[model samples]
Target: MSRIKKLLMVVVALLLLAVGGLYLYKDAAVRSGVIASGDQVLGADSTTLDSASLDLFGGGLALRGLKLKNPEGYQQPHFFQLGGIDVDVSLGSLLARRIVVPSIALDGVELLVESVIDLDGPRLNLLTIRDQLRSSRVKNAEENSASSGQRFVIESLTVSDLKVMGLMTIPGGGSWPIDLDVPTFEIRDIGKKQKGVLLAEVVGIILVAMIDKAIDMIESDGSDKLKIAGDIRRGLKFFNRGLKESGLDPKLGKKLLDDAIQKGLGDLLKKKKKDR
Candidate 1:
């Protein structure tokens, strides 16, 4: 019996050692992935991976002060630097094949839009940074689908605080500054197939907004009116199609959107009509 007990102890010790080694290995890998991912997303090299820790046993992970260098000529470097990003992801939630992002928080995100036209365009491109995030999520989803464990999914995304600065060129001279604060943004069920369809609708809305903003920028009374109407029509078409596919009342949705657009642009259109 003593011999058997000793043998069992040896086996248990070996098992414990194996488990400990695996935990450490996985912890390191997770940290490396986080650092690499942060670098890739910013299109910049990682300047720091100050602290990265993982607790696989308890399904907790943390990454802190992951910094990235700004791309050359990008305002982020000159004006404001991305201080760092903090992320905490759940391991069990990740393996459960559900939208499982516990939290992603970014701090000190900076952008400098130069008054110069060439720099301004690239600065404006920064607005599309969400696209890169979406791509990363998609890649994660694909990996999760492949794994037997539940994939990390994102059901809702919360933006705690966001600041945007837009530098616009005036027709004859100086720059006009537009500052925006996005206090909260929630995106739902983004990890599912329906995400594509939902994203299409969102992109459509953004396109409409861009067109309207462009028309406003033109600053010609008649031009604004014409362009606003065109944008309204385009947005309605997209809304109509989405509603139809969703098996909702397409006509009602289209009519409602049209009414809202018309009401909003009423004065502009009426003045144009009178001038004509």
Candidate 2:
């Protein structure tokens, strides 16, 4: 019994050590990936993935203090930063020919637009990263199609708990800035070939929602507003149907998506102006 107890203790110790090693290794990998990626975004000098509170599970990972430095033109040295992301990677999809980014949940992010360049330029623009990700998905799909039978599929992607600033300019360059404080933003069936078209619909839906709010704020004329809303809804319905055909579970997808939006945008919208 004494020998058996000692053996059990050894086994438990080994297991704990192994788990610790794996978690540390994963943390190192993520740090390396961030440093390499940040080199491109932040040029030289200070940019780092501070790993004080990082954890890696079998199916998911959590990061903290993910900071990005801006180039010479940027107003602040560290122009943008994210507090954390708790995300689950789709390993099966990754093994296949596609970049299957299933979900990304961002928390406490800061978006600072520099006054140096046109707000529309790549550096200062808030949505540039999202646009680049979409473009890369298409380009990668085309490239990978030549190699394997596996098709890239982003079945669902959701982002929630965002504190946004420096959003894109509203139509016709209006003075009333259209900043977004999204508690949630999401996309489903992102791997489909018609992702661009679907994204256009999603954008339209958001535009419609914003326009309704804007009309209320600015006291705009009501003549064609109803017609515009109908058109936007129609576009969303058609695109949403396409998502269903993309081999994704629409019910689960939409639920997660809506949750993200509600947490991200809803919270942002509800905050008092001075508080934001």
Candidate 3:
């Protein structure tokens, strides 16, 4: 009986060591994957993580300090910096072939736009990144069998302390300075089982939500703002359908908005000429 008890003790110690090693390896993989995904999605080489720790036993993950630099040829030092992501994971779902993160809180989101003279001329900052991801994702989806596809789900997400700043030149002329503060934002049903969500789809959501708020800061006439909003809604409906095939891509919603703004400016210029 004593020998048997000693054997059991040894087994338990070995098991603990194994679990400890596995957890440490997982932490490293998480950091590496975070940087790799960011680089691929943004088309930039500069991506790094400050820290990532996951308490699997506690069913939670904490990630902090991520920097996403601009794509090649852009002069901006970095596009966005993410402070952290705190997630409450559904631990049991990991073994079931689906990653189900129930709640996620993101903090310290920032976007910086800088004036850079690209030889290729001007380009949309964030929208360009979305276009790259959409093109590749659609191509891969076509290549793969739908039945074998994987899923990533976030039941609910909350983002706080978002700050966007800097200026970009419009089509007609002149540059517009942007300074925005998004204190609290929430999204539910991301990557739902019944109706899955894609990157472009989420981008559309971000675009619409951000624009809806930012438009108010433009200091335009009330009637003018309303007219712009009407144009934007119609444009989003059109572009979203095109990009997503059946539904709206909301990610490409910004494209439609840019076009609308350009047309409105052109029309204004024409009216001015007539008045002259």
- Best-performing candidate as measured by lDDT: 3
Q: Is candidate 1 or candidate 2 better by TM-score?
A: 1
Tens digits of per-residue lDDT for model 3, 180-228: 6855878787757434433333433443454344334332322243344
TM, every model: 0.48, 0.43, 0.64
Off by over 4 Å in 3: 1-14, 44-46, 115-117, 140-150, 194-276
Instruction: Quantify how close model 1 is to the true structure by its C-alpha RMSD in Å.
Output: 12.9
Give lDDT tens digits, candidate 2, residues 1-276.
Answer: 699999999999999998778666866766675565445332444456777334333556676887765545445656457787676665454354544555656567654543221222212222333333345445544554454434434455555444434422111111123244554556566546633222222322322333233323222211133233333332222222333542435574354345434554234334423464
Which runs in model 2 stand beyond 4 Å of their true positions? 1-24, 38-47, 52-58, 90-101, 117-153, 166-180, 192-276
lDDT for each residue of candidate 1 in 1-276, tens digit (9 for 90 to 100)? 699999999999999999778776875766675555555444555344666667665655665654444345445543224444454566565444443555555454443433222312212333233344456445544554455533333444444344445553321112245454434444544444533222223222222233233323333332244344343333323322343453335675455335434553244335545877
Ranking by lDDT: 3, 2, 1
RMSD of each: 12.9, 15.8, 8.4
lDDT of each structure? 0.43, 0.44, 0.57
> What TM-score number comes out for model 1?
0.48
What C-alpha lDDT, on a 0 to 100 scale, does residue 262 get in candidate 1? 53
Winner on TM-score (2 vs 3): 3
lDDT of 1 at 223: 28
